[model samples]
Target: MCQWLASNPNELHLVNRMDEVGSSKSVNFDGARKMALKQIEEFLLSFSDPHIFSEAATSSAPATLAQVVEAVRIPEAGNLICSAAAIGKYVSMLQNPSSLLRACAAFAFVQFTLPGGQHAMHHAGLLQNAGASPVLRASAEAATARIESKMYARIVLRNLEHLQSSPSTQF
Candidate 1:
């Protein structure tokens, strides 16, 4: 059920229902684990090569909305060119639970801003997260703010207000 939804573009319109479905407790833990493992395997093979991740991110060529979503789903591309020291630093930071949350938030910011700015028209697609911390959610919102503002000042202002008052998370 979840796999079909995840892979289907039509399911995006049924987001509310999808959320309800995802939030329901799973009755089959082993089945869920097996499914997750299968998806990961498929996701890995779906890419032409993992090395392309960093190349795609740093490339100046404009990316479509679909490409941006692909980048966010698999951030291993960002790490491809990062130095060993940088990787160690990230690993060390992830060791702390709080820092991990903050890192996720920061990652969300980079994901939205870089893709839309560096790439183009990449804002058409929405961010997707099955479960993310409050800080991470806020970070994505902030990134969204930065992106929309680049397109429209009025929207930027309105979103700023919306972001300040609302604590809810988007998909």
Candidate 2:
């Protein structure tokens, strides 16, 4: 009985209190975890330029990473992107600490929901269900986020708002 009371949620809060812990240091998760996002970025780049995405892309080469900010705007690239990663997954990645990861995620979303994409409506529905609007807004306002990432997020948000307001003819 005493053990149950001691291990309650309220007790856990006391253990994590800022005063007791000295500081509430925030954690950034861009170590080995970054590899997963990097792999995804490389895969995204492949759709637009497969011949160039050779072994060099697989390396930690900084130059290739620089080009990741702009989304692959090719209409045909959309469905292919969806085949590799889901819209909901990228929507959730908006909160990651790595700015580049957030940027890539945002760009991927922009491509997924671009007006001419094959799965725009379906991806939009997935994004809607994942609550992407609020997430994208928050990403745009995040001070730690890169300007490119913020801009892409805003673009996606505007698209979503337009989708909600307009007729079913287009997204």
Candidate 3:
């Protein structure tokens, strides 16, 4: 219980739910846990850059990791959940605190959705430059009038539209 509270200072109010041995039943801590999760989710959404994640996935990386990372983006949903979940997984995979700090530092330059926030089109950032086959890239550029357009850019645009209209979004 103390450990949880220490890790989640905002959840300190729920400490009373702990057992006499200072251990809380999972069910008893549900609310606090949920709140902590929501907070983490919100924080990640506001801090992490999906653009970096997507770009890294598509770069010349190992196939196995690329496959998993490519699928990290949410389907039919534009909310920040996908980015948050990916960032959480990324944080878990790091072996050193410096890596986490570096990631956080890099995120400082990316805008996001939040009060007084400026990132109105999060998808735009992710699609800034998309690598794709020459043929597909030519096709998209032909249609969009943007000569440099790529297939990844087109797909990202289409996906963004779908996500915007998705009814599951809360923000």
Candidate 4:
């Protein structure tokens, strides 16, 4: 059920809208926002189980990672990335052996480093941990190259190379 909703673009759009409306001061949309938030929270709670990926029978890790990436990609949903529970889940997934999971985690970091993502930056240290994978490095490099914001690109690049020698990261 969660996977189906996460994979649906239409549902994603509505979720994004709900986030925006929920944060606004308009009283008229309060009920709508609350309902939407409840649904989103329920979906997020699905990740609370540490073995969600391994236990799921229908969804592959990559697909689940993609769902996480999509959630983070939504501008209004940035709060989700900073949530302690969510961050723990993401960091755990980041360390997974699957290259796809690592890549998606890196993409989520990139999204978090962009404008209006200051809250999410608290988890930036996870990217520099000793377990950083080559796939993550590649994803960070690609994200740095593709981002239009110079400041954000530089920040992402710096995080990716924080501990590594400068010469090793040269283009």
Strongest candidate by lDDT:
2
All candidates in order of lDDT, best leading: 2, 4, 3, 1
lDDT of each: 0.32, 0.55, 0.32, 0.42
| lDDT by residue (tens digit), candidate 1, 13-122 | 22323334656855334555345445534533443233544444345343432343454443432222322333233223222233222232233234322322322112
Question: What TM-score, over all chains together, does every model reach?
Answer: 0.24, 0.56, 0.24, 0.32
Candidate 3 collision pairs = none
Model 2: lDDT of residue 76: 48
Query: What tens digits encode model 2's per-residue C-alpha lDDT throughout 5-122?
Result: 1222232223224223444456433343345446545543454443333322344343443343233454444554342234545655576555765776777676666655666676
Quick one: ranking by TM-score, best first? 2, 4, 3, 1
- Report the alpha-carbon TM-score of model 2 versus the true structure: 0.56
Candidate 4 lDDT tens digits, 65-111:
34433333546434533544444444453444433333334444545
Clash counts for all predictions: 0, 0, 0, 0
Which pairs in model 4 have colliding backbones? none
Selected candidate, larger lDDT, 2 vs 3: 2
What ranges in model 1 sit over 4 Å off?
1-31, 63-171
**Looking at model 2, which ten-residue stretch has the lowest summed lDDT?**
1-10
